[model samples]
Structures are given as structure tokens and as C-alpha cells.
Target: MNQPFDSDLPNIDAPAIGPPTTDPVPQPFEVKFATRVDRLPPYMFGRINNSLYQKRRAGDDVIDLGMGNPSDPPDPSVIQKLADAAADPGNHGYSKSNGISNLRREVASKYYRLYGVRLDPDTEVMSCLGSKEGFSHMCLALMGPGDTAIIPSPYFPVHMYGVILAAGNVVALDVADSEMFLRNVAYTCEHMAPTPKVLIVNYPHNPSSAVIEPEFFVEVVRLAKKYGFMVIHDFAYADVAFDGYRPPSFLAAKGAKDVGVEFTTMSKGYNMAGWRVGFCAGNSEMIRGLGTVKGYYDYGMFAAVQIAAIVALRETDTNVEKQSRIYQGRRDVLVSGLRRLGWDVTPPKAGMFVWAKVPEPWASSMSTMDFALKLLEEGNVAVSPGSGFGQGGEGFLRMSLVENEQRLRQAVRQISKCLG
Candidate 1:
């Protein structure tokens, strides 16, 4: 038996009702974000990440080779340096956004030791949260509306993302082969109206895992000087070469430092992916420009991380050699397994990826996206579809060698089953 409340009594919890007025109902608001943000392409990994999560939730063991996240841990000594620095109470203050002097000197020393490229630590070298951050900010610093930059096809997504975000136009040239790449660059330089403002290059390049000779960079520098364009060379895979191959820094070219800057990351060489430490060195102007933009955006990485990165740059040569061997071994296993199953795959000389052409059986039957999705379902193996990289990447797949060799072999076996 509940008593009814009187109608006249106040009900504080009740929603207020007012007499209808002439005002129209409030229509749902259409949110508008920056049109520059809309200009950027959708993240290509979202679908793959979602698929992997859904499959794993269903109790499936998907051998993942989708992302190039490093599998190895950094050297213990480097970690110890971080731990030691973290223990200091006074070391917790905001670090210099352009990086500490000692770390910048260490980076300069590294370039000099490895590439014979001398840089002024104070003016020409800068530290970044990672190469991606440095490169993106460099784009923001250098480019703007009505400017154009040249990017190779099947490029790292950020290459395009940075240019677009800067409101610069992108001219994507196919660099599938070395000679073709050179020819395209020359033709673009000769034919394009209003010569490009920047040219971005990567080696060992992602997805395709293409490596270039130091002589190639010499010619690139020549082209840049002639066309009056700046160059940004991403040498992130500087230490991931395989089979006695040593990747050279673009800055090693005689005139390269005059026209270009190079970005190197600790992620691949030092197995410090999550540490987010990298360096940009070469042209003083580019470094200063990026540093200016970064100053406004960040106070640099954690002091401990910067100290740890210094240790990695100064030490860790042996550790890098060991990791290279591990990636080489994984590359061997994946390449051999795929070849045995009648798929065409070339062993890459550098980088932690194998750019594989879709198997002949699936080539005619499916698009790269469809094939990638089907492989995840039937083979229980996840790979990045080539088209995810760009239009030039269509008809192929990019498989990361991030997993251990055993898992990579298992992935190949699973793919074999899918083929059957």
C-alpha cells in the first residue's frame, strides 16, 4: 500500500515541463573539426587492429605480423642508466625541448663514427620524442598552403600525413625500383610547375624494405641543390641491415648536409620502441626550424629517457648486431616458408618487414584487403594489406618480422593451410 503524492506538491526530482513556445526544437549539432584533419587519410591499421582484437577475444591464436613493433628488449645497461637517472630527485625537472647538450653531442658523435658526417652538436643536431614526431614537426615548420613536396609511393604513412597536415600538396612518385625511382625524381624536378619545396626519402624504406646506395643519396643531393628543394631523409632502419649489408646514412653524401637533414630512431636499432627517443641531424636550418616548432609543443621527453638514449647511442653496438641477426633469421624463415608454398617473396636486405606479393591463387580471386581479411580468418595469421600503405602498395602485403621465428614459421604454415 503506497500513498500517492499530491499533484500540487513539489517533486524536486521531476523534470520541468514548460508551455510549448514558437521556438523550434533544438536540432542535433553537427560537429566540425579542422578541415586539415579531415584532409589526412584514415588510419590504415584500425581495421587490422580491430580484427585481431575480435579474433583473440574469440579464443583464436592469431600469429600477428601486422605491425613493426620490435620484439627484443633494449640492452640491460641502457635500462640500468634509465633506472639510475630515475632515482635522482633533482633529475625530474622539465628537460630542454631541443634535447640536452650531451645527448646532442652523442648523436653527432654517432653520425661521425658511423657515417663520417660531422655535425655541430649545438646547431645541427636535435632530439625528438621519436623520428615520427621530429619529421611531422619539421613538415609543420617548413611547409604550408600552396607549397608542394615530393614523396615516394608506398611510403610510410606519416610522410604523406605530415605534408597534408601542413597544408602542403604531395606529389607521390613510384619508387618500386632504384632506376625507376631516380628517373621519376628527375622527371618530376624537370616537369612539375613551381618546383617542389621538399623531398622526403627513407632507407631502408618501409613496406618494400628497399635499400639505397650512398651514391644514390649523392645524386639526390645534387637534384635537391639543382631544384632548390630541401630534403628530409629518414634513416630509421640504420641498424637493421641483414646478410653483411650495412645501411648508410644519407648525410654521408658530400653535399647532403647542405641540402638535407636525417632522422634516426632508437626504436629499431636499440629495441627501444616504447622509449620514444630519436634524433634529427644534418642541415642546421631544418633542425632549428623543427626545434622552434617543438619548443612550443613539448618540454622534451622524460629526463631519464633522454639519459637512457644517450647510453644507447654511446654503447649498444654489439646489441644492435645481435638484433640484426635475429631479424635476419626471422626474415629467412618467413621468406623460405612462403617460397616453399609457391608464393613469390624476395628476402629484404634491411628493415623488419617483408613486402610480399599476394599469392597467385588469391591474386585473381581477391583484392589485397579481402585477401588479408581471409588470411586472418582461415590462416589465423594477421598481416597488413599493401593497399593500406597507398595506391602504389596494392596487390601486395607487408608482413612484419616482429614475431619470433617459431611464430613466423607457424604463420607460414597457417597460410599454407589457407592456400590449400
Candidate 2:
């Protein structure tokens, strides 16, 4: 019987295996993703990005103003520190997931120096791969099914998706007017059952470049306390203000440490985006939760990067301020050019984007998504459509000031020729 078990099959040395072995050749099993991944909608920018890729491939000199990526290099001194630290053999190993004591201390020092907010490096401060990584993990740490978060309307993708991925719901309130936003937050908290678990605020906001005064955060703290919710301030653009406008720190509000944490990174002002040095401070317990999540997910930022980040934070304030000035200059050039095009463009007081309305016949004739495609197709210039942000951003385009003055000027010329 044992010998006969294989008798109907092909012989071990046979050149032809017994007439096609009719059980149908082994096929790959179907793959199913987790429910959380399934919950996500299709990529919002896929259409625009795909066309951009095709255009670039076709040898078109398409000027890209889509992402808020910095086009400049970090300060020379900071680069040197990175090289020097990288050269040291001791700096090549795994770093503390909570960041080194010195770097944490530096973060606390900056908090106190810039915002008059005290933070304990040992407990209140931790560095992240980047603020977005920290923010997403923080949402996971605090959220679960049935939990809810309140975010700004026309949110940056991560703001809404992070909560959604953590199995939480969102209430996005319009943030064009700060007072109205605060009123809506109170209204939602007052009207909704169980209320929201977290309230996220971004000053010098992305996509819209909305600015809020220091008093705005005081109201936010008051509402957080009244609503019994926590706060998460995305202070990504904290260092990139213009026309003497200083973005307020949520941590600067009294009792902010009781209910929240603030996230900051060197990506914008210091132009160290690719280096991925991010900081979180305030609400030590919340910081601890984020640290626990991060510990399981990552060892930490690279040791050499951390070492260099310390130097960047401690020694590059002048350079950081200089970079802001450079951005302000670029902002002026782009805003002026757009205004000349008869688009309703507001010059932002801070942040790296110019959120301009889709002008003229196009605004009524097409959606922002279509308008963006037309610009890319005809103008050879790329900009993000407002719909990419959310429903509130539907009638606008968010153009970055990342390109240099010359490229920005050229982009405007291209846009004019395309539309004129």
C-alpha cells in the first residue's frame, strides 16, 4: 500500500510528470487587508500625483508646488555636526526610544525659552521620528472604537486619518475664523453624547495657513477643560511666521500640561525635514503613552541624527530665523503673482502655503480637482487641489512656497500662459 500511494503520480526520474497532474496548478491565495486599512478611502491625491509623475517622465519641466517640502539645505554648521557625529563609532548604535537626556533637555530648554512653558526633560519630553509619526501613535494610544476627536475642517490628511485608523470618529469644525471654531467646539461638546476624547489645533495651519493668537489657545484650554477632553497642538509651523507674526504655543496656556501635549519639529524653519527630528512635551502621562507606543514600533531616531538634532536645536536659532525670512520673501513673490492673476489670494501671515481660490470661469465650471488637473495639463505647473484637504478646501488650491523665487516666478508665468 505504501509503494502504491505514489504509483499513480509521476516517477521521481520521469521527464514528463503524468499528464498535466490535473488538480489545477497551485495558485496564489487571495490576500485580505485588515479592516482598518479597508476603512480608508482611496488616496485623495492619487489623480494629481499620477499625472505629475507621467508629466515628469515625459520630460516636461513641470514646476511642482504641491507638497510642503523644503527645497533648501540645512545650515552648514548643522550638516557638519551630523557628519562629525556620524563619524564617531559610539554614535552609530540604537538610540533611546525616548531620545537622549541631553536632547530632551534641549527640547525642554527651547520650550521654556520660546514659550515660557516649563517642561521636565525626564518625563515631559520625548523625541519622535517626526511629529506626524508621534501624532499618529498618540492617536492610537488614546483612541479606540466609540472614541471621538475634534479636528479643524479642511484638515491635513493625517489629522483625520490618524483618528480614523485608530478606530475613532471625527468632528471637523471650520477653522477659518478662530472664534467661530471655538464656538463650534463648545457646541459639539455640549450637543454630542459622551463628547469627544481629543481636540486638535494647528496654528499657522497647513493648506489654509490660518493663524491664531495666543488668546485663542487660552479659549481652547478653557474648552478642553469644560468639555473634559484632551488637546493635541500640531505646532509644525511654529517657527515659520511672517510679518512679525508669532504662532502661539498651546503649552503656553495655563494648565495646558494637565490635559495635553504639543508636537514640534525642525522640518520647517530649520529645513531639517529629511532628518526627522521631532519633539513632544507637556502632559507627562500622555507623553509616556506615546513613548510606550513608539517603543514597540521603533527603536528611536538614529543616534547620529539625535546628536546632530541637539546641535541644530541649540545652535541654529539664528539660522532658523533666517530661513523663516527666506520663506517670507518667497511668500510675497508668490502671493503677489497670484493676485496679479486675478485669483482671490490672501497673503498668509505665517506657514509655507498660499491657499488661493480657484478663480473665474474655472471655479464655477469645474471642481478643484479638475481645476488642478487643467493647471498641470496646460500650465506645466503642479499644485494641490483644495479637495485634497477636505470639503471645506473644495474651492481652493494650496500652493507651497518651497520653490525658489525664480522657479515660483516661472510657475506664475506658466500658469498665466496656460489660463490667459
RMSD of 1: 8.3
C-alpha root-mean-square deviation, candidate 2 = 5.5
Clashes of 1: 0
lDDT per residue (tens digit) for residues 87-177 in model 2: 9999888887999999999999998899898899999999999999999999999999999999998999999999999999999999999
Cα RMSD, each candidate: 8.3, 5.5
Give all candidates' CA lDDT scores.
0.90, 0.92
After superposition, candidate 2 runs with Cα above 4 Å error: 1-28
Looking at candidate 2, the ten consecutive residues that score lowest on lDDT are: 1-10
For candidate 2, report its TM-score: 0.94
Please give the lDDT score for candidate 2: 0.92
Model 1 spans with C-alpha error above 4 angstroms: 1-24
Clashing pairs in 1: none
